[model samples]
Target: MSTPFSPRLIKGGLVLVDPDTAQVQRVIALQYNAESLRRELKGQESGEAGTDRAEPTRFKGVALETISFEADLDATDQLEFPDQHASAVAHGLAPQIALLESLSQPSSAQLRKVNSQASSGMLEIAPMLAPLLLLVWGAGRVIPVKLASFSVTEQAFDPALNPIHAKASFGLRVLTVDDLGFASKGGALFMSHLQNREQLAAKAQPVSLATLGVTGI
Candidate 1:
């Protein structure tokens, strides 16, 4: 269907379009007057320039004589409505769509929740994915990534052992790192590294270990 409607120039020569259905609209004139143009530049010099918002711009004076039609868009494309006026087409026009609204700041909280659930599921399948990726990538000669990394780490720390010395290893839980670092400064690490049991018993300096003997009277 086609109909000729009156064209109106909106702000700054932007023509207003409200073609409800498919229709072709022809661009007419956008000219100005010669005397009005002369009056607009009367006080200025012959080579004067405008310095408003748009630099190097032409002024459409009161005259409409110098107007011309610019074929901005072909008549084949549908008319576009500004975003605020046209919002019903946002959700793919479907009721059962997952992302049900416009993608904006207000939808961020819901998007985050959906992403969180998806991430948890991805993590759960990570172990399976690792072996699959390794198999797909390795082609049977190479080992799986996780096991190979663990084996390599263990090989890097192969410690030396002496045959004559009976080694001792124990865990002593302490309160804090300040206390631990202070103890280390006073040779706690040197004493900790000492492995010989006979040497430890011979060099064990006696300081009365602090113990609070609690009794229910």
Candidate 2:
């Protein structure tokens, strides 16, 4: 496990965890960032019959919520991975690339089980393959996400072509219950996550007695 940035202050950042093992694989520190939350509404136009006037239905349309964030990474003086032998600045992009690549590959265990089942005519055993299919879905998942985009611009490089100074931007679209059906693991986790966040936020903000007592005195 990676140690906290400092003994006194806790380092905060994005954590990529293994879906199966629930192990933290990487932690990228939070820097300058922006979050985008979008909602889409749909409605039908209607008219009372003749007056050449149209109005939207009183009923509200379905709201689709999406959230995304862009964060910057600088490695000039920051050690992204202290345990590594190379210069932190020079090797900053290593973990980012590794995460992308890892996400692209499916889990070996899942694949082996799937292959084994197929070889044994498992389809005949369970044509729908309910339980097994669910497990196989998103095998080797590195953080439940619909999309992850990253771009790195190397401003400076060492003699060995390793980046010494660089700027990287990373973006993510979290997978929610809507994206991954409610039956799936990701969907369940997403719902639980929302509930947890809601609770935390509620607790984080408390009604201050000092403020209430000073109202309009």
Candidate 3:
């Protein structure tokens, strides 16, 4: 009997990169791939309801895009090997959950600095910025995004009330050159993502007008 063939799977992940140096700071890979991904796009039009009729269909820039998905994380398998996965045995999924939550927060050091400056009666302090975040789905799609929202539901817990199984839902707004500007690393990545989509669209076969029961306008 011959064995059936199985295709290789690629894991999707979120990566945090240093904005100035373009160095990867952290990588959080989803334990299980999302069952489905939802995406929405809204165009930036030049004309509004009361605007000029001319160039009504003109676009100011790339359309705003957003993506949402749910990822599942379980510590069942890790709990079996307590020696190696001691953290999972004790904290369950808390560490993993915290890692995701930290993406939206500034570093602890930054917070401390601000507090110190305020105590010293400093008039002004610079705003804190989070690391640049990248959503990598596959070889074909990688783009910068801002975490708009995040929610996690603890489904199962261990005897100690530690969450062992959970589902994390993420809402992300795709960042483009308009948001990041052409000089930024994220802006460059957005351009590459746009060009890749254009290339993919070009590869798609096109049908003539005859297919729609029309020869010419």
Best by lDDT: 3
After the best TM-score superposition of candidate 3, give how far the Cα of residue 96 lies from its true spot, in angstroms: 0.0
Best by TM-score: 3
Candidate 3 runs further than 4 Å off? 1-6, 48-54
Number of the candidate with higher lDDT, 1 or 3: 3
lDDT by residue (tens digit), candidate 1, 12-72 = 1111111222122222121221121111112212234464444234543211111112112
lDDT per model, in order? 0.23, 0.49, 0.93
RMSD (Cα, Å) of model 3: 2.6
* Per-residue accuracy of model 2 over 88-199 as CA lDDT, tens digit each: 5455555554554344345667678778889988665332211111111122222345344556576766566665554555444556665666776666766766676567
Model 3 lowest lDDT segment of ten: 47-56
Per-residue lDDT, model 3, residue 211, is 98
Q: Model 2: residues >4 Å from true position, as ranges?
A: 1-12, 20-65, 78-144, 181-185, 196-217
lDDT of 2: 0.49
| Model 3 vs. true fold: TM | 0.92
Candidate rank order under TM-score: 3, 2, 1
Better of 2 and 3 by lDDT: 3
